[model samples]
Target: MADGVPMVATLAAKTMEVPGVHTLSLALDTHSPFDFDYGQFNMLYLFGAGEVAISIMGWHQGLLQHTIRAVGRVTRPLVALEVGQQLGLRGPFGRGWPLAQLRGRDLVFITAGLGCAPVVAAIHHAVANRDQYGRIVILQGVKHHADLLWQTQYRRWQALGECQVLLAASEEHRHRHHWRLGLVTELLALAEFDADHCAVMMCGPEIMMLAALKQLARLKVADEAVYMSLERNFQCGRGLCGHCQLGPYFVCKDGPVFHYPQVKPWLGREGV
Candidate 1:
């Protein structure tokens, strides 16, 4: 089921430094503009080094922006690419933000470290469909004040009055800039909202999500109300590759977004 399309996209523009990460915007030739929800991810292919999943930060004029953190070989070149460069890509794949289903519910979104990418899409989607939901709370954890991404856009989202955001740093000693220091979970304990009325969403480091999930259980949040994404090495663009399989589930097809119960049992299992 791997999507072996072997297609390529043109780099439309590249930005130097985007708040918390580096960004590259690409314009791909397609028959139609693909549809995607906020929390979904696309499988990005690099011919030599292989593939990685990245979220669409924003899109316009047939372009999709991916704000990436330089971590491995494939992404290292991604950060160095100039305008007019060609890049291999295939998909607007994986599950996205639960926009429609979240209607009428107050929402809480939490993220830490590199997890901000996928969550941003959900935030953008919700703000666009503000009439469907109630209050929104955004909680973030980072290493330092400078580590927070998209300050300008984030400030604009905050201005909508539908969202309240915070940044928690792991370090104790701090900066003059306004933000909390510690963990994203700490913000949860301070909030007195009812879990029954809110849907919980998160994107971040494995440990961060693990800690966040543990805390949510204490909050009495229902299993169905909690959600997180999955990531794995994919050899084929389509589901046929089997490299990204988790038992019967294919991260490429079944999900990159799974309800807690679906993946909780496979946490330490091989092929997960």
Candidate 2:
């Protein structure tokens, strides 16, 4: 893959796990080789349909892996794509969770299901440079045990920081757990969150992040210290398209990740 062309490969791998859901792991090579900030997303093109925003969950060699759960038109084709199917890709875009800037301060992460991908990236960067940050914690929630991706990686990350998680459905297995068993927000009640200099990040549905924001405020954390990954259409990774627009900001440009205080006024309204 040349640095000037998109790798645009066929579906490198796909699988249906007992999470009972069909998930696809795509490996794409891009001409513009780039390093992605933890939580940045890329625009993926599925011929004959449209495009979808996907986060890079893992990357190795020249291949960047995206773990996708089949949901809509773009994703459906992605799920149906065979090992040799081709597709278009651009980005590694969006402002990622800014844990790097908050280095030396306490940090907390709350995510749900696939939302954990970005959170994992932040953790990967943070832990690798642990001396630059303070205490770290993670709380992840998914529909079921199987919906949880990267268990081994999570375990590895857990070894580096204070990690915890929740699973809505626990019917399939049993393990000695430090894992909580409810909504991700519930963990807020148990944490002694430091609002003074600590940063809290939440990524999931808007409602989930909103709830986390409210609780962080109650703990005296300023809105500036609270961040979220807004889930929007994100049709254009370059920010020219308006699908993920929010007033003066473009989620693709301004952020998929933003501090709550920076975006509070624009949440419910429309028109960018």
Best by lDDT: 1
Q: What's each prediction's TM-score? A: 0.89, 0.84
Residues 94-188 of candidate 1: C-alpha lDDT, one tens digit per residue: 77666678788878888887788888778777778888888888887877766777768767766677577666888752563436777888888
Q: Local distance difference test, per candidate?
A: 0.75, 0.70
Q: Give per-residue CA lDDT, model 2, range 139-221, as digits (tens).
A: 77666666677777667765654443333323342353646566667777776446687888778877777777777767788
Question: What residue runs in model 1 are displaced by over 4 Å at the alpha carbon?
Answer: 18-20, 172-178, 268-272
Candidate 2 yields a Cα-based lDDT of 0.70
Collision pairs in model 2: 3-31, 5-31, 7-29, 7-30, 10-85
Which parts of model 2 are misplaced by more than 4 Å?
Answer: 1-7, 15-32, 161-176, 269-272
Error of 2 at 77 (Å): 1.5
Q: RMSD to native for every prediction? A: 2.6, 3.3
